[model samples]
Target: MAKAFKYGLKGIRGHLEPAERELLRSLFDDVISMLEPEERANEDPLAALVGLDTDAREPSDRALRRLLPNVMKNDDDASLEFRRYTERSLRENKIGALKAAALSLDREHLVLTPDDARHWATALNDVRLVLAERLDIRDDADADNVHLMQDWAQAEDVESYLALVYNFTTWLQESLVQAMVHSLDARR
Candidate 1:
């Protein structure tokens, strides 16, 4: 029973059919079965995140230098390729999250955190200009309803460098959040 719930948990966290609520119930049961009495204490995530000296961990610059694994951060082209891959990953993650949120809430109207969208609308439009001339994708631009490439344009930052120690959390989140709102509006 415990194993069944644990296995079901993976599906609950994933994009799947609504009928999977039965599995979600199993997952809840598994979580209960897995629960162990606290040895010391546990902090709620929001409190821990906002409180001072919360045992928050910081990664060194050296760690960041090696952040992009499997893509090889050692070489220059590899670095560029890795950045591209990272942007693609973020875009996919945000959009997928959007869909997931809509499904979870069972609402046609969905909203996303600003951090998810990363405002690059103007930048994306500019990229469209370049793609139009360079790749000759202009005339066919409106023809494709899905704006995959534009998302890549806003994905310009090679290193969104972790926000806890970095600054982009604010500037980037505002843009991203706005973008999500815009996207929701478009869908609506």
Candidate 2:
């Protein structure tokens, strides 16, 4: 079991059992792997240094597409053009957040500064997005269906296991958001 994150005198605090920590770290790593852009040979070093990706195209994977959505839904050419310029940086930023969150799991106790909280929140949300795509959770009804799989004992299949994971991440992210809100309110 994990304690819900809370804002207090020191900072945002929470506790996860070792197993929970491992689970979160694995999730973060998986998302980071998915977001890492492929290296292109013969690419201009100057263009790469400035976050330009002339070869970038919309991701074929459903989850990757969700993570790196088009700037304009209805305009394919414009969207692809924009992605060529921005997708690499977006992937790098997401990877950075996921890596930071995964590294934080090495601590026995979770004590988060505002920046850490922001990273955790982003990483968790990305994990949930991937899980949701895997679980085919497209709407409120789909999420409700997945949320019903709360029993670990009943996780007899991969989909059930993913549902349980999704539900757990959703709960964790909600708690984080609540703690973040409390922290904001405390400053006022």
Candidate 3:
């Protein structure tokens, strides 16, 4: 039940209830897990469809594919080759962003320096993207339907709660971006 984000002179400022903060921490933890390189090779057939298995290395998960898209979609050989060289570094950058988000959550009040704000924006967008996929949110209309259904959705409905969180994060990201833009404009 903390206020939504707003830009401050120092950085972005906001507040989140302890429970909300914990939820965010959990989300980042899950993302980190998903981004982790699998010990065994990917067994997903969908990877083959995308020609992600062209190389000897394991293909990435669908979520990872969304996060780090192909460098060359038309040429399977080039795309897989590029992925092999860059996927590790991309994963590392995502992990770093998630870690930064967790560090921000450690504070009582949410305060983000410029660097921290960038990390939060990156991490939060990733979380939202994953959640939206899980929720099958195709467009604004689908998202609106989710909100409309909230009136009938029970408090115990996990799906409903997740949708609420997705919506909340979307708003937070939008607000943070707006604040940053305002700050930049002010300096002119």
Candidate 4:
């Protein structure tokens, strides 16, 4: 019989003494799966023609109904050790109007703190261009979107911030522990 397993698990073949690295990878995979395609729903004409229909377009869903959520609102990584996602959040935004808008945030004028969500605070226009100069936005549509983000994020004060952080941290811890437990259980 084997002595231990790796995924923080034990005894199972291919699972001996699993380390944090494996845990991280597992967690990363889970997180990535949760990353979501930015455009969740935009009205499919064919689906509309069916009479009664719905479009979930999101990563998390139950068997019967797909859910539509604002991306990263309830990210499962709240349980992890670090705030940084394995993938750079804006990797895809680099060449778009969103990228231009991102370059325009000044931080000083906007009174906008990093909010952990960092540049992802959605939009700065709602804050009255407080951080405008420091931003690099060029698209007028994105500017409109910023106006929208500012309104949405204004309410995300301390309590909500802590809640998000807590959720991510707890999620990571649980996944790690679960993976470990799974490995150990398999050992038997």
Candidate 5:
């Protein structure tokens, strides 16, 4: 079982079983794999013809498209240009968030400084976003539909597991956010 975080004067603390930590580590690994920029071959015929590499274009992966959404939705050229300039930095930030969370998992109990708590919040949000994409969950209605399918034996598979993880992460994120808010309030 996973534990909810509680804020302290020093920081925030939570406990997770080693297996739980491993599960989260694997999820983070998946997200990192999907988000990491890849090197393209210089021999692309398309690149030769267009004088640019198509692989250098905006993300073609569905999960990535969600993670780094276009800044300008209506204009393709502008969106692509913006993505080209900003996506690398955005990816690095996400990677940093994931790394912070992973570092917190090195022990049986997590102790996150205020900044680390913030990073964990970002990491949780990113993980949820990727999981949502893989699960094809578009809206709250879709999430509810997954819940409705819980009784069916077939639904007790990966879809069900993903939904459970999604729900769990949501609760965990909420707990962390609330703790942070209360800490801030107390300080104020």
Candidate 6:
């Protein structure tokens, strides 16, 4: 079992069992793989260096679209134009956070600095978002239904297993956010 993260004298700290740590690391890696931009064989060096993807289009994957949403919801042209200029950097930033969070999972004691907390929060949220998409949790009602699957013994299918993972990540993220709030309050 993983302990909920809490803010205290030393820092924001928590404990994860070996299995929990492995699970989190795997989740983080999955999200990182999804966020990584594809390499272009004959791409413009200058444009790539400047983080511009001239041929960038909206992601076809529902989870990816959620991660990298349009700047303008109703206007396709504007959104594509903006994505071409910004999506690369956005993907890189997300991947960086996911990697950092995964690395932290290797630590014996889960003690996080403020920056690490932010990264962990980001990584966990991203994992939850992906899981939610897979679990078809489109609304509060859908999420509530999934949340009903609380027992590991009840995980008879892949959906049930995913729901359990989603619920775990949601709980973890919530605890992290609360600890972050406590850290902020302490600094005031």
Q: Give the Cα lDDT of each candidate.
A: 0.31, 0.93, 0.77, 0.31, 0.79, 0.94
Q: How far is candidate 3 from the true structure (C-alpha RMSD, Å)?
A: 5.9
The list of candidate 1 runs beyond 4 A from truth reads 1-70, 107-188
How would you encode candidate 3's per-residue C-alpha lDDT over 17-120 as one tens digit per residue?
89889989999998888877555465555664453433434345666667878787588777778776677667778989999998889887877887888898
Residue 168, candidate 3: C-alpha displacement in angstroms: 1.6
Q: What TM-score does candidate 3 reach?
A: 0.82
Which runs of model 5 end up more than 4 angstroms from their true locations?
41-55, 147-155
lDDT of 2 by residue, 46-147 (tens): 999999998998899999999999999799999999998999999999999999999999987899999999999999999999999999989999999998
Worst 10 residues of 5 by lDDT: 47-56
Which model is ahead, 4 or 6, in terms of TM-score? 6
Per-candidate clashes, comma-separated: 5, 0, 0, 40, 0, 0
Question: Candidate 4, which segments miss by more than 4 Å at Cα?
Answer: 1-155
Model 2 lDDT at residue 134: 92
lDDT of 1 by residue, 106-184 (tens): 4222232333223222222222232233332334454242233333234445321111111221222244445455555
Error of 5 at 29 (Å): 0.8
Tens-digit per-residue lDDT, 1-68, candidate 6: 88999999989999999999999999999999999888879999999999999989999999999999
Model 4, residue 65: distance off in Å is: 43
TM-score of each: 0.19, 0.98, 0.82, 0.21, 0.84, 0.98
User: Candidate 2: global Cα-lDDT?
Assistant: 0.93
TM-score winner, 2 or 3: 2
Superior candidate under TM-score, 1 versus 2: 2
Model 5 scores a C-alpha lDDT of: 0.79
